[model samples]
Target chain A: MLEIQNVSVRYGRHQALFDIAAQVERGKITVLLGTNGAGKSTFLKALGGLVPTGPGASIKLGGVEIAAIPAHRRVEAGLALVPEGRGIFGKLSVAENLHLGGFAHRARTDEKERLERVLDLFPRLRERMPQIARTMSGGEQQMVAMGRAMMSHPDFLLLDEPSLGLSPLLSKDMFKSLRRIASEADVGILLVEQNAKLSLEIADYGYLLENGHIVGQGPAEELRSSPAVLRAYLGEEVVPA
Target chain B: MTILVTGILLGGTYALIALGLTLQYGVARIMNLSNGETLVAACFSAWLLFTTTGINPLWGLLIIAPLGFVANGAIYLGLLRPLVRRATSQGMLEVDSILATFGLLFLFEGLMHLGFGGAYFNYQFLAVPFKFLGGSYALNRITAFGAAAAIALALYLFLYKTRMGTAVRAVAVDPEAARLVAIDVGLIAAFAFGLGGAITACGGVLLSTFYTFNASMGAVFTMKALIIVIMGGVGDVRGAVIAALILGVMETLVASLIDPGLTLAATYGLFVLILLFRPQGLFGGAAG
Candidate 1:
């Protein structure tokens, strides 16, 4: 389990996240739903140590504290983040990018096996290995980003807006892949997404954020039907009559 | 034919010089205006070793390259790392690094002038002429070209084939993404800066074998290197090698066919033309 507590983030004088606490369990999918500027992205970055958390913040992965480590060290600690815009190396070939994904010491021993598993999860990537990552379509690039993260042998995978810029059908397929990844790889997934309906359909647990605060939390099924979730994220039209 | 051969030999050395600057700027994000001073310092070291201790410049390289690496690493850690930390953005860091390295260029030049007494220095090693393609060339020039080619080839393989080298290139492509992959971006940058210094020092040792150099002449090589780097596109290794060869051939043709003094003029003229026309580089895509 990855547990985060008292996680606050500030950029200069503007506070981005305020006293946010969350827990993500292995072999399960957890979704964070929020509107833009609700600190969803910031929260994920803080967890990955891409952003500095407040002094009192504590992030524990499998009973080990990891919040004070640097971003790369956090990857070595088995936390991988796929930030917005995919964050793939545009100039590098997909093969090289995937090879680098297994750079952390924890991933080194079973790198070949991990590569096989990642390729199985995203079969399209197998054909595009020699191509530069940036030249690929949005869906394909997303696959590369996810596959790259998976290569790190991460205990918990954090993804921000994985569906953004992807086609609706592709997004559906991506969510399906996420479900498979969590169950088969035995990895925890903490996803920050705007597509509430699709994410909740696949998630085991959910958290709702508003103005950098967690306004609500519940099981995915409960949040899917909660009045506040419908009003805030799903909208009145998404509510079933 | 002689001009072509001579130009190619000269180009081989130029490629080594430009490769160092490209690595320093591309991966380390340092403009490194003092790049030529490292070259000059190596040249003087080669001269001193050969004249005082009867050491061949080729053998002197074994000593000079590591010194360059350590000195350059110290400079990055002590001087440039602070600038890198304080600067808020890439543009700000570029400005800061340029200013800092420019100051270093002058400082090194002045110290070299005081120490070396502002005299032109050269050493004769393997000065015999070797016949090639119906023309004779200095054996030292050929040896220098051979060494440069070997070094360049080794560097290319390291970057393209090895895991650590790919990490260095990864840092160049996108540092933030590199962090996601668990690469130590800062450590890689420092290593690249130091390796660049070592390569540049190698170029200096090669040049000192055949060419005369003085303390103040470092800026000339720096300018030539800057021109090649810009002409080839920043951070593009293949482009740098090609551009250096072109510059060498053009400079030689101009010196042989026209007035020898117009070589610099011709070099800058080409620079202006490239800036106006193919600023992205001969082989590079549109500038990012």
Candidate 2:
């Protein structure tokens, strides 16, 4: 489980987030939804410790305060974030990229097996193991990004805009895989996406974020039907799934 | 014909100098403008050992290699390391390294001036030129030059063929991902910096044999080596050597036909022209 209390972030003199807070449950998918510049990516970056938390900010992972943990160390602490840029080394091969994902736990007994497991999940990667990642198609690259994160065997997985630049059909494919991954593995995912409908369709629960604060939260189906959620996200009435 | 042979051989030698610099800038990505300074500085240690005690600078290797590595490692730790360390989140911290190394250039020159005095000194070895064909080519000199070429070639093989080499490439490609995979990011950087230093001893010993040197020589060779690096495109060993040799031959031809007075300015002018045409050097694959 992951918890945040009174988190605030500043970029130079501009206040980006003020008193933002949320919780991601163990082994469940939690979707964070907002318009562009709503601090969605920033929140995930804070969780990964890529962005430093402001004073009085407290975050706990597995019940220990980790607001000050560095980004790489946070990965070592089993918190993995697929960054907004996807952060895949463009020149490196897919296999090499995944190998780095397992870097923090490389000395663990099952490291090689873990790599095989990731390749197993995304067989397309196994097929093009030697190809340069930068040359891959956008959807394939996204899979590589998610698969790279999966290689960490992280307890808490934070995905930021994983579906951006993807086709609607490909986006649908990605969400289906996300649902399957959540149901099968004990990995907790805090998926941040602009496609609120697609994200809520896969996630077990969802939160509506505005100006860096959670304005509403509930079960996926319940949140999908709220007048405010419909107004903010759907731009119309929510049709029953 | 004589100038051509001389140009080819000298190009080989220049490649040797540029090779060490190429490794540091292209692979390590530090833009070590101080490489020529470090190479020249390493020569002083050899020069001091030679002029005083009459020890063959060959034997001086035992001292200067480690000293060069330490000196390089220390400067890297002190100056360039901080800039390179935070390059990830900040995204390609480019101008910072140029400033750090430029500052190091003055520091090294000042130190050399203080210790050895600014006067140019002749640093030569056994003048045993072997006779071949109809004339003599300086055997010891050519062989010393050959050693640098051999070193650059061997380094190319080592970097491309070995696991450690691949790891180094991995660091070059991506430092953050390299850390995530459990590579000791600091150790890799230190090892690389030390390597850059160690190779300078090789270049220094070779250079000290053939020329008189002052603390001021670093800037010139650094510029030439940089020209070679840029000319070859960053990180390509094949490109560095070809560019160095071509420039060497071209400079030799120009000096023989035109005049020595124009060599420096003309060589540099050509360097700028080539850069203007292909900002990526000959045979460029990776820019960094």
Candidate 3:
């Protein structure tokens, strides 16, 4: 289990996240839905130790406090984040990118087996292994980003807008892979998304954030019918029965 | 024919000098104006080794090159790293780094002046001249060129075939992304600066075997290296070598065909033209 409590983020004078708390259970997907400037990204960054949190903030992975852990050390503690825009090394080949993703686990004997597993999860990546990452399409780059994180074999994965710029079909494919990984691989996924409908469809639980505050939280099925979620995110498009 | 051959030989030296600057500025974006000082320091160290211990200056490379590498690494860690950390903007970092290197240049110049004094010295080495393809050439010059080529080839293989080399390239391409992938970016930058120092200092050790020098010669070599790096399109390694060769031929031709006084002037004139037309250089990006 990964737990965040009373987490707050302030950038100079502006408070990006205020007293935010969330929990992610193993083998489950937890979706965070928010609009632009709603502090969804900030919360994810705080979780990954990519951003500093204010007083009273606490983060733990399986009872271990990781709030003070540095971003580089977070991976070794079984935490990984696929940051917004898919921060891929564009000049490197896909293989090199994956190789770097396994940096923390390099000493492990199963590193090779883990790499083969990532390749199996995204077979298209195997085909483009030798090509430079910059030459790949948007969907392909997203795969490399996810595939790279998977190479680390983290117990918890924090994804920030993974579907941005990807097509609807590609987004569905990505969600399917995420679902399989969460269930079969026993990995916890903390996902932040702008596409609330599609993300909620696969998420076991949902949190609705607005202006750096978590206004609502419940099971995904209840949140789908909640008036506040529909008014802020879903708009006129109703959740399919 | 002699002029052409001499130019080619000179070009190899220029390539060696520019390779260091290319690594410093082109890849790391640090304007290391003190590069010439590092080279001169290596030459002085070799000279000191020769004069004190009677070791051949050619063999002095084993000591001087590593000294240069360590000294340059100190410069990066002590001088440049703090500036990088304190800088709030990229432009500010570049400017501050350049200023810091200028300070280093003067410091090295002053130290050299104090240690070696105002006198010039010629390196003691075999000067047997050999005829090749109807042109007479000094054996030392040929040996220097061969050494430079071998070092360049080794550098190429390191950057292409090794794992740490891949990490260096990855950092060069995108530092922030490299950090996300767990690459210690600061360590990479330091390694690059140290390696740059080592390679250029090795060039200096070779140079000491064939050339006469005083403490102040570093400034002239520094400018030449900067020109070659700019002409070669900055971070492009292969382009730097080609541009160095071209500049060598141009300098030799102008010196012999026109007037020796106009050699650097002609080279700078061409550089201005290249900057005016293709600012990113021959191999730089569309607008680099």
User: Each candidate: fraction of true contacts kept?
Assistant: 0.87, 0.38, 0.40
Q: What would the per-residue lDDT of candidate 2 be over residues A81-100, giving only the tens digit for each residue?
A: 88787878787788767766
DockQ of each: 0.89, 0.29, 0.56
In model 2, the runs with Cα more than 4 Å from the true position are A105-109, A180-185, A236-241, B1-30, B48-63, B80-100, B119-127, B130-136, B149-194, B235-238, B255-262, B285-288
**Clashing pairs in model 2, backbone N/Cα/C closer than 3 A:** A103-B180, A103-B181
2 against 3, candidate with superior DockQ: 3
Candidate 3 lDDT, A65-160, residue by residue in tens? 988867767777888889887888887899988887876643255878888888888899999999999899999999899888887778998899
Write down the lDDT of every candidate, Cα atoms only. Answer: 0.93, 0.77, 0.85
Clashing pairs in 1: none
lDDT of 2 at A223: 77
Residue B278 accuracy (lDDT) in model 2? 76
What class would a CAPRI assessor give candidate 3's docking? Answer: medium
Question: Against the correct fold, how does model 1 do in TM-score?
Answer: 0.98
Q: Taking the tens digit of each residue's C-alpha lDDT, what string does model 3 give over B195-227?
A: 888878987877877788789888878888888
B100-172, model 2: which lDDT tens digit per residue?
8888888888888888788887766866777655667776567766777777777788776654665666677
Error of 2 at A153 (Å): 3.5
Off by over 4 Å in 3: A105-108, A239-241, B56-58
Off by over 4 Å in 1: A236-240
